[model samples]
Target chain A: MATFIDGFLWYFALAVFVIGVSGNLVTIILASRKVDLSVPRDSAFSGALRTLFSRFLPDQHMLSRIGIQVVAGYMFHLGLFILLFFAAPHVAFLEENILGFGWTAAPHWLFIVASQFAFLGIIMLWLYRMTNSVSRLISKLDDHVATILTFLVMLSGCLALLESFETLRLLHRFLVELLLIYFPFSRLMHAFTFVPSRLFTGAWFGRRGVDS
Target chain B: MSERLERGLSKLRSQIDPKVKSFFSSCVHCGICAESCLFFTETRDPRYTPIYKTEPLRKVWQQEYTFWGKLASKLGIAAPIAEQDLADWEELVYDGCSMCGRCSMVCPMGIDIAQIIFKVKTGLSAAGFSPPDLAETTQRAVDIGSPMGVKLPALQAQIGHIEEEINLKIPVDVEGSEYMALLSSMEIMYFPEYISALAKIFHQAGVSWTLCSDAFEATNSGLQIGNTEVAGVLVERIVAGAEKLKVKNVISPECGHAYTAIRWEGPNFIGRPYSFKVVHILELLDELLQSGRLKTTGKESSRLTFHDPCSIVRRGGVETQPRHILNAIAENAVEMTEHGAMNWCCGGGGGVSGNERAEPLKLKVFNRKKSQLEELDVETIVTSCSNCRLVIEDGLEANDMEINIVGLTEMLADHLVVDNSQ
Candidate 1:
């Protein structure tokens, strides 16, 4: 059981993660070819680049209106980013198994704080989605599935943090594998696709001389 | 099984470009666009959420475009899109939305919610589910050369009246003029003062401009109805008129959607650039003011605020021009809480005013503007779009608010410094 979990399933998940993400990206890029023939009032590339970064900072006027979502979204995304790349176990796992190189990991206390933030944020967002009328109306089966699966993965990973129980670690690994397989097909693709999505909209607004 | 349903589905299929795909993929049902929409804010109905309004288009995208959706359909599990779906969405797409683009502005993923909803409107139109009043207006626009049925004789009558009132010649079809001006049917019928105002301002500025006798109507109901074929026909009339008169520039009248249809979307609709340039009347007036051609005196004593029309300021990129004109003429030109490009819509844009069925809903949503005005406590409201003026007048009357609404051009004309040299 240990051998299959550590070797075959691990490699399978990694392969699917890599290939599925790239395949989905290539498909999206080739899906349409829209040539705008109108005269542009501004540079499309500059507008795209500006929006790619500008969206990270909410507009001052909108901050009060969307304060809760903005704060919770940042906490979840930033904490998850740190836990994924900078936590000691994740850094060790990548260096030993995938990259053959290493960077210094976050301190043990910081890792604990990050996971707590991630858990708090994800729970808040999921609860808000269930409660809010607009969100409830638009939420699909896929959205709930993605949120629940992400929560289970994070919960299992926290249980496995002690590194003493093989079952806990394998549970985390299996759930992550499922998430990997589901990522490209689900709205989780927003993580990488947001750049190009914003670029398309920004270019359109740029041609019309409006800031996106 | 219906032909309209088939045409609608085909159009929806064609509208699913890469941007639509990306927008759908990036949206996570966050529901942030709800707070930005006045309809949802006023009604508290989840159905009015801007993103939820795109459900039909999104369903079409999922069923036909996505991998899992395609597989589910192949297995006979996914629900097929039916005629009822399009029929139900007609009210939501036409009556419940003003296309203010506030949702587009607030979307964190940078999705142009308004543009996507426009594609949905195209589908609804093709499915023959447009509001009856808007459809009738579009038909009249196609058949009578103007949506309000204002013909050359009527305009000539108004021109004769304005010429007599202002003591200035209103040029018509004058060859070799520097600019060819177009008027909205509203300006011609309800507010002939706009014509006299333009004559007064143009004469003071010494600019050679003429109205096209053949294509004086600037508003395109095709754009409002989301019918490209009819929109192209309206734009072509202006193009033909401009070419015939050999004008260097064409000034779009102070109507919101007319400016958008003529100045921005006209070239693309007609599939070619124009020999003459298109400029909004506000843009031309602002330019003349900056260049010292147009001058104004005697500030308006009443405290006033400018209502930025959605299509003119937000969608047309003429945000600063109206403010420039207003600040120059009004002694106390205040601003609303959310002014300029982000101002709340007057709830009558996107042909809502033309649709009689939407009047009640439009008035309900005008609570947004009501609160904005209440906050400012201005004596009068000035706007550039005639549609906004009329709609706000209706809204103010329905709510029993005692606010006077004026067009920016007429207001500016009242303050024009008559040159003694002339």
Candidate 2:
């Protein structure tokens, strides 16, 4: 059971994630886009690049209105990023199974802190989604599924942190595999799609010489 | 599905290009766009949320483009879009949204919400679910060469009146002129002063300009109605007129969407680059001022403020020109709490002004502007777009707030240091 969960299921999930994401991206790239013939006031390339990073900081006027989401979004994304790449277990696993790399991992204390931030951020975001009328009205079943699935994966990984119990580690691996497969199919695609989305819009506003 | 629903869905599916796909995929329904939208903020109704307004198009994208959606549709598990769905979204896209692009600016994910809303409008328009008044107006534009049905005779009459008053020749169909000026129906019927002002300013600046007898109307009801074919036709008329007149530049009048239709979206609509450059009237004034041709004598002493027309300032990228011109002529020019690219709409853009059904709601949303004005306590509001000026005038009257609205060109002309030599 451990071998099946750790080896074949893991490979299967990774394949699905890779194929699904690539296929969706290719589909998007191949879709017909209207060619703009107007004389551009500014460079579209620079606009796209500027917007790619500029959107990381919320607009000052919007900061007060979306303070909670901004804070929680940063917490969740940064915390998850730290845990995914810098955590000891994740690094070790990636080195053995994927990247053929064994970079220095963050200390155990940092992992705990990062996990707590991720947990708090995700929880707050979900609660806000449920409570805020606009969010509640707009959020779909996909959002809830993605959030709960991510939470379970994170929770299982934390429970298996000590690696003292075989069952907990397997459960964590199973959830991780499930999440990998679900990532491309769900709103989790935002992690990758946000780049091109920003680029397209940035180029548009950039061509118009507006700081969007 | 009925034929109308099928046609609407097909049109929507066609609109689901790379940008739409990317935007939809990136959205996590965080609802941050809601805060940026005036309709949602003023009404506190979730239905007015910018992202929420894209439901019809989003649903089409999902059912047609996504993996699970395709599977569900094949399995008959997903609910297909119906005619009533398109019918329901008419008000949200047409009335609730001014297409001011404010939500587009504030979106954290960088989604062009206004662009998508425009695409959604195309689908609704194809489905024949648009406002009756806007549809009638578009028909008038198609039949009479003007949205308000302002014929060439009427424009010629207005021109004769302006020429008599200004004691100058208002050039009409003068071949090989340097600039061909286009006027909105509102400018001709409601504010002929814009024509007189243009004549005075152009004469003082020694700029050769003419009005195209064939394509004098700049306000595009097709753009407002979300029918690109009609929009393309309108743009082609201007292109043909400019080409025939052999003008080097086409000046868009002091109307918001007209500038958007002619300057920004014109070439795209006609599927080619323009033979001549398109310039907003404000841009020309600013240029003339910088070159020391157009000089102003004195400033208005009243506590005045410059209302940035959304299309001209934000969407059109003529933000600084109006301010430059205003500062040159006004003694006291205050800005709204939120101005420039982030300025609130006059609650009547994107064809909302012509939609009689949207009047009450338009007046209701004017509170956003009313409060902005009340906060500043400004006596006069000067704007570049005639549509915005009219809407603001209506808004002020509805609230019974005694504030005056003036066009930037007319205001600038009032202060022009008339070149006696010319």
RMSD of each: 1.6, 1.2
TM-score of each: 0.97, 0.98
For A1-212, candidate 2 gives per-residue lDDT tens digits of 99999889989999999999987787677767888998888989998999898888887877898999999998998889888899888899889978897999999898989999999999999999999999999999999999999999988888888665789999999998999899988899998888888999999988988877
Q: Please, what are the lDDT tens digits per residue for candidate 2 over residues B1-422?
A: 78888888888988888889889999999999999888888899999999999999999989988888999999999988888889999999999999999988878788999999999999999989999999999999999998888999999899889888889999999999999999999999999999999998888889999999998999998898899999999999999999999999999999999999999999988899999999999999999999999889999999989888999888989999999999999889999888999898888999999999899989988889998999999999999999999999999988899998999999989998876776
Q: How many residue pairs clash in each candidate?
A: 0, 0
> lDDT of all the models against the reference?
0.88, 0.91
> Which whole-number lDDT from 0 to 100 does residue A199 have in model 2?
92
For model 1, the docking class works out as: medium
> Which segments of model 2 are wrong by more than 4 Å?
A30-32
Classified by CAPRI criteria, candidate 2 counts as medium
